[model samples]
Structure formats: C-alpha cells, structure tokens
Target: MAADTTEWKIKKLIQDLKDQYSKTVRNNPDTVAQIESAVRILSFLVAGRFENGEILSELIYSASNLLVFLNDSVFKAASKYVSKVVNVTKEKIKRWLTVLEYTEVFLEMAAKKKWGTKGAWIVITIIQIMKTALRFYVLVKLDGGIGSTPAIQPVDREILKTAEDEHDNLEDAWDEEAAYSAQEKTFTLQSSGRQIRTLQAAEPGMRTWGVPESGTQSPQNSVLNRKRKMLNQPASKLTKQRKWAEGLHIARPMAHLISMYISGLDSWKPFLLACGMDVTSMYLMGDTKDLNAKEKAELKRRNMMLLYYLMRSPFYDKYTKMRFIAIFRFIAQYVPLSGFIIRPLLEYLPTWQRMYFYVWTL
Candidate 1:
C-alpha cells in the first residue's frame, strides 16, 4: 500500500509539472508546436521500442526541430522542471539513466543531421547533460546503490560513411605532399657488388647532396657541418622579399575566408566582427602614413565597436577566451605596442573563480 501511494504521488507530481508546462506554452504558439512535434517524435521512439529505421528517421527530424527551440528561455524552463523533479524523487538513479539515454539519443540524431554551426550548441548542451548524468551515476555507485548500466547504441553507419567521405575530400583538396613526392625521385641502385642510394631535392635549383670533405668524419659530424653551412648561407634580398610576399598571400586570404565563414554563423557574428576589426586595425597600424584623417576616424569607430561586442559576448568559455588572448598576444609581436587593443580584450576574459577554488581545495 505504501509503495502504491508513493508511486501515485510521483505520477501526480509529474502530471502537475506537465500541466504547468502546458499553461506556460499556451501563450506561445511556437512553443506549443515544438512540444507537439517533440511528443510525436518521442511517441515513435517509444512505440518502436527505440528500434526500427522508420522510427529513427522520424526521431531525427523531430530532434532537429528541438534544436531550433533550444534557446535560453526554453532550456531554462526545462532545466528547472528537471531539477525540481530530481530533487523530489527517491529513484534518482532511474531518473538520471533516463536523462542519459535521452541525451545520447538526441546527440546521435543531431550528429546524423549534420547541421554544422547551427547544431554546435545543441551538441554541446547534450554532451554536458550526459557528463552530469554519468557523474550522478558514479556518485550513486559510490554510495553502494547499484544501478543498471546504460547500453551504448551504435551510431548510424551512414553518418560514419559521410564523415569518412569528408575526410577523403579534405585529403584530396590538400595534396601538396603527394605532388612534392612525385617530383622528387629517390632510388637505390645495385652495381659492382655495392648499393648506392641517390637523393633528389624537391626544389628545381637546389643540389641533392654535397660531397664529403677528404677527411675521416663521423656521419653525425658530417650532418652537423651540412646544417651549419646551410644556416650560415645568407638569403638574397629578392628571396627574402618573395618569401614575405608568399606568407602574406597565404595568411591574408585564409584569414578572410575564415572570417567570412564565421561571420555567417548566427552565434559567432560578434566574434567574427571583432576579428575583422582587429585585422583592420592591424592593417592601419602597418600603413598609417597612407591613411587620411577620415580613415583614422573610421578605424577608431571600428575599434570602439569591437570593444563593445567583445564585452557583450558571453558565449565564450574561459579556455576559449584564453586562446583568443594567446592569438592576440602572438599578433602583438608583429604590431608595435598593440597592448592598447589586446589588454582591454584580456581584461574582459571570464574570471578564474572555479579554478581558484579547485586550487585552494588542493
């Protein structure tokens, strides 16, 4: 009787939460639509017993729709309900396992969807939830409560094949190593009861190898001498200029391409804009003499805008912000006294409170 009463109370609580959620969604037709879609998708999953290709397809479509609804408001409300239910439940392990399963399935579906930048946040959130559930499971086990281990499901084979195809395409796109290998021929020849190895340089004008001096020298000493000679040779002015131009040619276009790709992302617009502003500032600093007063004013306005955006963006975590700082620090080496820009950006980085607390405990 007691067990039956407990189960009834839990069901009543869940129903009450559902009722509250329904009331909240009533005013927002979009939320209602999203919830309905989720219910339909979940029904297929439950009805098919989490198997069958047709059901998985429906689940994937629904999961994609859910990703679109994973904004701050929706996520917060869902999190609050989950937290409250977890707090009130005696079957913590069962609740956590359900969450873990749902998160894993959603992540798998999201991966199959291949939504790129739009799905990044959804993937991150699901991974975080999985981590939390795993932690909870560990704690439960440590308390001598044995819970059923979650089974790992295989990801769709088509998704794996798609990833492999992408990798192959990337390899084909960047085949410089193959081209260089094809140009240079290294061969071993056997003649007069001795084997001779021939080395060929990749560059057209460079010699393959230098003849050793008419003296007994160890192989290590010979290698050191060759390296020292190569290092001592001064580069020609034209060669240096050509190398510099080649570097700029590679870096500038690549930077612009990256900026363009990142700027197109809804979540990354501010960061991309700030990066563009920094690049513009770098160019202005490089060639200040050519700039008119109006251009200088425009640069200042851009710098201010960049600062504002950097201050506003809370999307970046501590590590990401640190990496950005490191990049700017590297750029500072080329630009004269860029601390004016870099220092302010560094100051806006997330605080290390958690890190400090961990270190204090240690």
Candidate 2:
C-alpha cells in the first residue's frame, strides 16, 4: 500500500512538472531542448546507467541545470495556489537556481580552463557535481521531505531531538552561570560595604576629615604597598610574571599563524583577482558618471584582456573560477557581445553550460 502511494506521488509530480512546462516554456525551442536534455539525463539515472562516478556526476549536474531551468521558466509563472502548495516562491527558486548555475559554470571553467584537458575536466566536474547534489539533496530531503515520505521518520525525530536537547542545555547553562555571577557580585558588594563601615567606625577621627592620611593602611594604600613590594622583590620571586610576559610574546606569533590559516594568506591572489573582476564588470555594465566614452572603452579593453587571461590561467582553483564565471554571467546580461566573444573558446563545455550562458545573454 505504501509502495502504491509513493508511486502515485511520483506520477503526480511528473504530471505537475509537465503542466508547468506546457504553460510557460512550450513556445520556446531552447527551453524545449533543455527539458529534453533533463529528461534524458533523468531517464539514464532511473535506468541505473550511471554505473560509474563520471556518468553519475554528469547526471547530477544535468539534474541541477534542469531544476534551475524549470524554476526560472515554468515555476516562475506558477499560480499562487500551486506555489503555496509546493511551499516554494519564484524569487526564492530563482536565487537557488542562480547559485547552482554559478557553481556549474565555475566547475566547467575549472575543469576545462585550469586543467587544460577534456579528461581532467570531466573528472573534476563529476566530483564537484556529485558533492553539490549530495549536499542539496540531503538538505532538501531532511528539512522538508522533498521526494520522500512526508511522515517524520526515526532519523528526522532523532535530529529534532538532538537540536532541542542542545538548545535546552545551552539555555540552562547560561541561566546557571548568570545566577552564580549575580550571587557572587552581591556577596562581594556586601563584603566591601561591611569592610568600609568597619574601617570608618574604627577611625572616627579620620572620618571627620573626609580623607585618609598618606601613611594610613587604607584599601588604596594597601594596593600601593603590594605593588611596591612586588617591584622591589628579587628576580627569582618574579619568575611567574616573567613567564606570563613570555607567553604573551609567544602568543603574538601564534595569533599571526592562526590568522594566516583562517584567512588563507597563500590563496589571497585568486581571491583579490575574483573581487577585482566582479567590481570591474559591474562598473562597465552599470551607469558611470565618472568616466568619459574613451576612458570607458580603454577600461573595457583592459577588462576583457584580464578576463581572458584569468580564464586561461592554470593557477586558479575551482572556487576562484566560479567567481569569474559569475562575474561574466552578470556582465553578459548587459553586454551581449561579450558572450559572442567567449562562445568559441567555451564550445567544448557541456550543453547545460552553453545553455546557461545563452539564457543569461538572451
């Protein structure tokens, strides 16, 4: 009976997808091609044709691209009732799609450009696609039961239980710490007040003057005496103080090492280049009152050359390559000619990769 219900749900999902496609994307040939590619890829997956990691990777990548295309085209036009039922909005779906497409382009560039070989590209692409698909699938499946049984399973219950337990533990610990600190503070204040009163009662003669004599052993005078005694002590007695200062000096280098590890100082060049490209692309495509036509042309020329150099550079990692692709996609949306210039070089990329560029440029 459960098997039958699951089958029914899958069938309904497919029918709904078909209906959406017909309504929004049936008129576009390019969109039809994307749909066909997605269907073919999914069919392969269902048939267990993805026997190896490479094929499995391609299938997952294709699925992601398909999902993105559907979200942007079909789901974007979905009715409020349908969208609410699915618990997904057009804008939300678009953002996810953008991220997937950005990632896809990045991997594609990393594989083809950085590696400089089709075989290397295919391997890297497959690994990245698999990783991303697994992450997204786990998140969606665990969070909302997407394409799964709606009833909370034992695993889901355990996850919820763990989260609740952690939250309760944290709350309890904080409350206990706060209460202890408050009590300690109150006790200290009471002890200090009692000490002040005892000293005032014992020295009635000094209380009338409103000031303690310089020689009097008041709290302030005691603190000064302690400091003076410490400063005058032999070097052997100050071993702990010297050790503490040495530790602080050592911590400076340790902190620098930690900062380097966290900030990835060695990888800063690629990060900087990515940021520069993104900024430059935005400026060229955006309204700029500061630059004349000649200046803009000169900047555009330099920008194009820099983009080409980065695309051909082998030094960039997959993440850096993705940033470049994202920047290009953004620029291509405003400057159609930019897409044409790079089309020939990227002809060897997958259909989905090419389609992504075409879709944005269009």
Candidate 3:
C-alpha cells in the first residue's frame, strides 16, 4: 500500500510537469523564437558535440536578446501572465538562459582539455554576473519575492479531493496489510480529528505535532487533517517582523549583487555585507510568535533557501565546492561500487552543476 501510494505520487508529479510544460508551449506564440529553437536543435543533431555547439548556441541566445525588434505580439502570451507569478516571468526564462550559456562552456571544457584553458572561466563569470543581476532585480522589484511560489494556475479543489481520497485508500490498505498474530489481530479504531481511522490492534499508537496518542490517535489521519486544515485556512497577512525580515533578506542578495557590479569594491567586502544582512534578516524572521504555525515553517524554509547564495559566485568557486566534494565522498563511502559508477561522473558533474545550480532558484 505504501508502495502504491508512492507510485501514485510519482505519476502525479510527472503529470503535473507535463501539464506545466504543455502550458508553456501553448502560451509561447513567437514564430521567430520557435524557429530559433528548431534551428538550434537541428544544428545540435549535426554539430552539437562538434565545435562544442558554442557558435550556434551563442547566435541563438544573442538573437533572442535582440528580438526586442520583433512585435510585442510575440511576447503577448507570456506578457499577460507577467507579475501574476514570478516563477513564470521573464526573469526565470533569462535565468535559464544563463544556465544554458554556462552549460555549453562546461561541455566545451569537459570535452577537450585544451578547451578548458581557453576562455571557459570568462564565460562562466559572465553567466554568473548576468544571473546575479537578474536575481537582484527580481528580489527588489518583487515584494521581497519571498514565500513558496504558487502554480501558474490555481488548482481545482476536486483534484485535491481526489488526492485526499487516494490517501484515504492507502490508509485503508494499511489496515488490511498489517501482519499480526491471531491474539493481537483485533480491529481497533483511532480518532484522528476529522474521521476515525481503522487500525490493527498490533499496530502501536503514533503521535503527530504533540497531538496526544492516548492509545487511539492515528498518525496518518492526523497528517491528513493537518494538510486539510492548511488547505482550508485563509491566507494571513505577514507580521511586521516577518515583513521587515523578508525585506532585509531580500536586500542581502541585492547588496551582494550590487557590490559585484559596483567598481573598486575590495575583496571580502560584498561577502561581509551579504552575510551580515542574512544573519540580521534570519533573526528578525525567526521570531515567528506573531505568525501562525504554518507561516513560521514557511518563513524558516525561505530562510534556508537564502543559502542558495552560498552556491553563487566567489563563494561557490572558493569554498562550496570543497564542501560538496566532502559530502559526496562521505555518501559514496557507504554505497557499493560507487567508485566505478561515479568515476566517469566525477570528471564532468561539477562543471555541469556549476552552470546548472542558478536555474534552481526559481
């Protein structure tokens, strides 16, 4: 039953991705952009690996940037949705472009040792600078742009109900599947806020969020109730501290990016400024007493995501790579045949990941 629930979740995840991709495709009506994409794909088929596919890729990206000459209609589909959700906005697309740009450089370096010495670092620096500027704009212009991003389209309640039904089905299946000796096989009911859960006598009582066990509470049902409550609750306003913390947190990246962009900035200056802002912001927002339980968790999560900055320029190249290497080595130590499986990957994965990480922010 657990396996079935997991399978259902995986399928749902895939379906959601497909739906989003399709929506993007449907909304994109730019003929020139479509042609450019097609040409790039066809060129890749012929010379993607050869010459590192850099020239065509660069031309396409430049053409895209220059496409401001085209009619606004080309951007109409996406423009209407602009400001609706930052995730679907032009900034996200540009961030992806930065990733693609760096990826090509990574490919160039990984393929030919000679190519590695020739201008790849310059290309990577340029990508990072461009992406950081974009992030700075999004953070300041958008409302601290904090919190979990909602979907492009609001989800229907019916779909949620269906999912809840599946969860309930899984709960029922667990009761049927629990193994027990005949002496301990008696059926028992566990009250879990919204509904009674049928559980096996052999199953031990479980608790959630300090909801007392009292030998009758069901963990799974409690989880369902919490989820339902979260969904049903009305949206709440940010507390003064939360708003201030978010503002400062948003300012952290801005300060970092601004320092880089500014001339004559000395070493470790931007680093200090960014770190200082982050610590201050975390302290302010960490006071979740004024916010609801859910708000507190979300605030903390957003605070954690701020660590993505650690993966950015200067810091990533200087410090984070070592940490990643140490962590990877620790994990690989336990897995059998990891050395053989990871040997090929070790050479190029870091190069690819460096280029890829920025796109993950959105």
Candidate 4:
C-alpha cells in the first residue's frame, strides 16, 4: 500500500490536472496537453498501487464504457438494450457513494460529446476523474477494512490476461524484475507460485474425540475441552443494546440538524450557485455545440435547482445525519478523556447534579 500522504498527493495532483484539462479543453480544442496529463493519470490508475485498486479500476472502466455508449447517438438510438444497459450500469455504479459517483457523473458528460469533435479531450478528462476517484476509493477501503484479515482465494489465470489487455507495456514489465519488485510485495503467495504445498496431518480415525486413547484423554478431546472453556465467558447484551439505542437517538437529532442547516434559506442559495460551476465543469464537453449565453444561463438555473434539492434531499438528510453521528460516536468512544467527562452525564443522574458538574468543568 502507498503511504496515506502519498495517496493524498496523487489525488491532489489528479484533481489539479483535471481542473486544468477541463479549462484547456474548453478554451483550445487544438491543445494536446490535456491528453498527456490524462494518459499519465490513467497509467498510474491502471498500475493498481492500492488495495481497492482492482475494484476501482473495474468500476471506472465500466462507467467510461457506458458513458461512451450513452454519448454515441447511433448506439443509444439503435437498441432497447442500450437504454436498459445504461440504467443497470447506473444502479451498479450507485453502490459506491463517494468518489466513484463523482467520477461517473464526470464521465457522463464526456460520453455525451460528439464522436469526431474533441472526443479525445473528453476521454482524457474521464481518465483524470478515474485516477482521482480511485485514489480516494482506495483510501476509504483501506481505512474501513484496516483490521480485517481477508481470506485467501484460488489464483485465477485471467488476472494476468486482464493486465496484459489493459496496458501495452505490462507484458515487458512482467519480465523485468525491477519493474515487478514493488508488485511482488502486494502479491500473495497463493496468487504467485505455480506449485502449492502444505504439511500433512494424522488421519481423523487415529484422533479419538470423546474417549481416551490410552490412559489420558485424546488430543482431539483436549482441544474440545479448551474450546469449551473459551466459550464459557460473560456476554454483555444489555450494554450492547444501550449503546445501539443511544446511537439511534443521536442519529435522529443529527439528521434533523443537518437537514435544517442545508435547507435553510440563508446559505443554501449561495451554495447552490457555487455548485453550478462544478456541474458546468463536469458537463462542459457534453453537448456538441458550444453553450451560448442563453444555453449557459438555462443550464445554470436548472443545475442550481438540481444541486439545491439534491443537498436538501431526504436521502442526504438522513445520510448526512448518520455520518455526523457516526463520527461523533467514534470520537466519544475512542477519545480517552471525553468518556470520563461524558459517562457521569450519560448515567441516570439528577439534572441538578449534571448541571453542577457542567458548571464545575466550565
């Protein structure tokens, strides 16, 4: 895995590249710098440095393919399967909420461009978006599954074929020891060598379970006894229930707070207006014709409304609240001194005593 800071730097670089690429593509259709930046970013992404790299790459590639299909009027108008495929693709893509969604949306516009006119520029933008999204996705997946012990799977020959297809230079890189030195660290033993070996154990019939083999209990019986002893520990169902109840209570209030804040008349209008720029940036390559003043104004108005409602959406209301409360609970649980302070207040104590404690702390 890449260092957290290195991953972040890569993401930042990709984002900057995309921002510049978008501006350049819009201003100068003849400029080829965007394509170079995009290809570099895509190469990094396809190199698959991070843990969730494969999943991220697959989703990005699928989304890019779908976007290309969507933009091509010939494909869209030709078949019922195309429309069905697009809907299915959207649903599948929605499973990933963070960077993937943003990348998918970005690609949606690029896919909308006319086939012959600056389509390559749009494809480059798609590549840049995928790179940025993949870095963030990898970060999130690693953080979430940090402590998990992933079960090993049987090696698939198809992996090598897929890599070869994705990158023209991969075949040569596989031969060069220096090129694969870093990759060797990431590859599991199960996925690497042709030969597999494991130590053989004694037959099951030789291992008696319930009865003693000679004078003492059998090895299998001893193992069972130890497992029984381990299982006879106290369980805390009440404590678990209390924690869950508190989390649910906190979440409801947090959702209302977020909804109220986001939907408020004060700052929401400006936020919506600001998001229009982002929407415009993403969809700049979508239409074949240059967006005239009227088209631009209309797009801004429609998209601002879309952004405002999206932010204030019921889905976001609950989601935003859940995320906030989750963080709050994580802090409350993991922060050492805060638990000491909060525990007394959380307990079934008198209101006056709580007030007095708060006053003392202050």
The candidate that wins on TM-score is 3
Which is the leading candidate under lDDT? 3
How well is each residue in 1-362 modelled by candidate 4, as lDDT tens digits?
46998999999999998666544443432233344345445633652456545334444654544333222322223222222333333323323323333344233333433353245335534443443343334323322110000111111112212222333464344334333333332323566543322122222445322211123343444554454333222212223333333223223223333443476524444334434433443343244244343334433444454443333434334455456446556777999888664553333223212121111110
TM-score of 1: 0.19
lDDT values of the candidates? 0.41, 0.40, 0.49, 0.36
What's each prediction's TM-score? 0.19, 0.23, 0.44, 0.15
Query: Which 10-residue window of candidate 2 scores lowest in summed lDDT?
Result: 147-156
Better of 3 and 4 by TM-score: 3
Q: Model 2: how far is 257 from its true place, Å?
A: 41
**Candidate 3 lDDT by residue in tens digits, 232-320:** 34335656676676667545544665675573233567767777777787787664675555556666676676687666556666888
Ranking by TM-score: 3, 2, 1, 4
RMSD of each candidate relative to the true structure = 25.3, 26.3, 14.4, 25.6
Q: After superposition, how far is residue 335 of candidate 1 from its true place, in Å?
A: 74
Report the lDDT tens digits of candidate 1 across residue range 1-362. 99999999999999998667645653454665566567666644453344444336445644544443333223333331122233324345444544444445444444545675446445544544454445344334332121222221111112212233444664554453345442143433345443222353223343444322223343433444454343223212223333333233223323433554566433455455445544553443443344443334444554454443333333344234566767888877678879766664455343221111111110
Name the regions of candidate 2 deviating beyond 4 angstroms. 1-88, 95-99, 102-162, 181-277, 281-362
Query: What TM-score quantifies how close candidate 2 is to the native fold?
Result: 0.23
**Overall local distance difference test of candidate 2:** 0.40
Give the C-alpha miss distance for residue 267 in model 2, angstroms: 27
> Model 4, which residues run further than 4 Å from truth?
1-100, 103-258, 261-362
